[model samples]
Target: LLVALGSGGPGAPSPSGGAGAGGKLRGSRTEQSDDQRRKVNSRERRRMHHLNQALDGLREVMPYSQGPAVRKLSKIATLLLARNYILTLSSSLQEMRRLLSDVRERHKKRGSYSLVFFGSELHGEM
Candidate 1:
């Protein structure tokens, strides 16, 4: 049975080792290993499909819209762009919050006439 499994039938020549049953088993295992490799490749393709789906979703919500003609971004580029975009947005929000706080502080000080203005004033007439 083992010899038949390796060579596919009786009186078939084994590819490896001698004409013994052990050599037949090795040849059969080689075929099995090839099948396992194919399975692994298929799994990798599925994983890449999921990864592409996630990337497409990300591209939809990102600040810069991807053009139809644009090629797909690499994984590293996508991740880096996302990181930098988020950081820049966070910094902008923080700056706006700080400015708002300063405005509120100025408004509070205005009631007491403690705010000072040093810039040149715009004049309608000399």
Candidate 2:
């Protein structure tokens, strides 16, 4: 009639506790580890809650919210998407700069700018 859920302590019915049905319930209530376990579990849950809140905050600033019902992005997806967004912005800036340079060169002088390939001479103007 004894029960031990945690601490792996063997539950042995005590003859002095009166041979009654309530003896089994009292054995589990007497373990101090149960309170400690509850405290540990509460801390873990709070930590996880904070982690999820951080993820949700990250999702709020992402650029991919085009769908009618956008779902929360996974951690990997968020990271990948952010990486791609930065790459796209960098490439766009590079292309715009290249175009601006081309325009300025064309306005200043005709056929003044030349593109040279690596390990080879300029066969013709780019």
Candidate 3:
């Protein structure tokens, strides 16, 4: 026989048909459920904490101002700014490499190495 103790919610089955044992079983299940919920909540909190820490680290390495008067960047802004900064640096490196290659080619053509002025060349003067 099965008997519910309080609100007829998940009562245990017993061969001798007793409400006391069924109530204890239900209570145990409820406690286990609560404990599981607490564990999940704790894990979620830790995950968020770690994520925020990583974002803060990214902010530190970025080129944005970190003055006291300056407001902190939002998560989205920080990510976008970092991405753009990387792109700019990449472009500058590529330009430098191209300039070096041109200088090398010019050196090969002249046979005699001469002092090459890159100041005007960088500004569109050949």
Candidate 4:
């Protein structure tokens, strides 16, 4: 495999010389061992495959619609939707808890509103 390291035109040296517009040595390709290049390519492919897999997993669990007929959300959209979903769930839970607490407080107040004081003495469970 040809692996060059420099600025060149179309991975090739100019007819005049290897120097570029600035008269600097544009570039030259150094032949790399086939085995080494193959290994590097394989590693890059595998890394990208793994990244795609992770994104797919995230898409599967996201709140947005996911089906063969439906288009999957982009990376940014998926993240945003997930965040919104979590926030919505959190708000709903908080509202439910507040309502429950209010009910309990009302119940407590109902029973404790009738307090009797007898000669510098307080008689009330609340």
Candidate 5:
């Protein structure tokens, strides 16, 4: 996990080297390429750091916490599930509202009704 976070690990190159073409002078032409590569890496790392911070914030607000009680969800998985849940909830609310409106219209037209279960097979006659 530490290695994945770019914190520290045996495979990671030491950061003690100075940021200059001197570091890659073995191949003069490759020196500029190395600098460009480092710039791209640094930009990518910063972007990922910001994204991870946002994910951490999301985890905090979500109902579950990391423990034996509940396993921690990955950032991507949490976001996907959150989107699905919100969409489902919004759809359900809209359906309920529509049903209520339909029932009100029915009551106004026919005067009364008993047990009207919307969206299901359940229906009755007063």
Candidate 6:
């Protein structure tokens, strides 16, 4: 989305040099330009609203404090935290897969395995 910022209001000069045209044509073009400017501004405002909403949704799912006393995360902070979280999860998942592979290899060699959990033992054989 390319948006042209800065002032281009009624007092601004028309693109064509002012010498040739009559008053009616100038007035019409000015009205058209103003209308176009308004439409562009409206679209820009809507785009920003949607962007902020998406950022808010991201903040909601983040593992940060959500209490009223805590200030909402700034846009940069929200994005950085999300990136860090994804990297952490990716690393943890890789570690878990490696551990599981080791356990499976041990079970294959023994032809049976016992998995203990919370003071309980689960014994199984292939």
TM-score of each: 0.55, 0.44, 0.63, 0.48, 0.50, 0.68
Better of 2 and 6 by TM-score: 6
lDDT of 2 by residue, 18-126 (tens): 2344335655544556788889999999999998887777677778843578876887788788788889999999997898677657745664444443456443343
- The candidate scoring highest on lDDT is 6
What lDDT tens digits, residue by residue, belong to model 5 across residues 48-68?
A: 999999887777766544557
**RMSD vs true structure, all candidates:** 10.8, 10.7, 8.2, 12.4, 11.7, 7.5
**On residues 1-126, what C-alpha lDDT tens digit does candidate 6 reach at each position?**
111332244444334633233323556776788899999999999999999999999988888636778799988998999999999999999997898678878997889988764579878885
Best candidate (score: TM-score): 6
| Worst lDDT 10-window in candidate 6 | 1-10
Rank candidates by TM-score, best first.
6, 3, 1, 5, 4, 2
Q: Which stretches of candidate 5 lie over 4 Å from their true place?
A: 1-28, 64-68, 106-126
Q: Against the unseen true structure, what C-alpha lDDT does each candidate score?
A: 0.69, 0.66, 0.72, 0.67, 0.69, 0.77
Clashes of each: 0, 0, 0, 0, 0, 0
lDDT of 3 by residue, 1-126 (tens): 123433334453454333434455556666778899999999999999998999899988887647777788998998899899999999999998898778767876766444435544332223
lDDT of 1: 0.69
On the 0 to 100 scale, the lDDT of residue 17 in model 2 is 43
Regions of candidate 3 where Cα sits further than 4 Å from its true position: 1-26, 112-126
Tell me the deviation in Å of residue 89 in model 1: 0.3
Looking at candidate 3, what is the lDDT of residue 25?
Answer: 50
Worst 10 residues of 5 by lDDT: 16-25
Query: lDDT-based ranking, best first?
Result: 6, 3, 1, 5, 4, 2
True-vs-predicted CA distance for residue 17, candidate 1, Å: 7.7
- Which of 1 and 5 is ahead in lDDT? 1
Q: After superposition, how far is residue 70 of candidate 4 from its true place, in Å?
A: 1.5
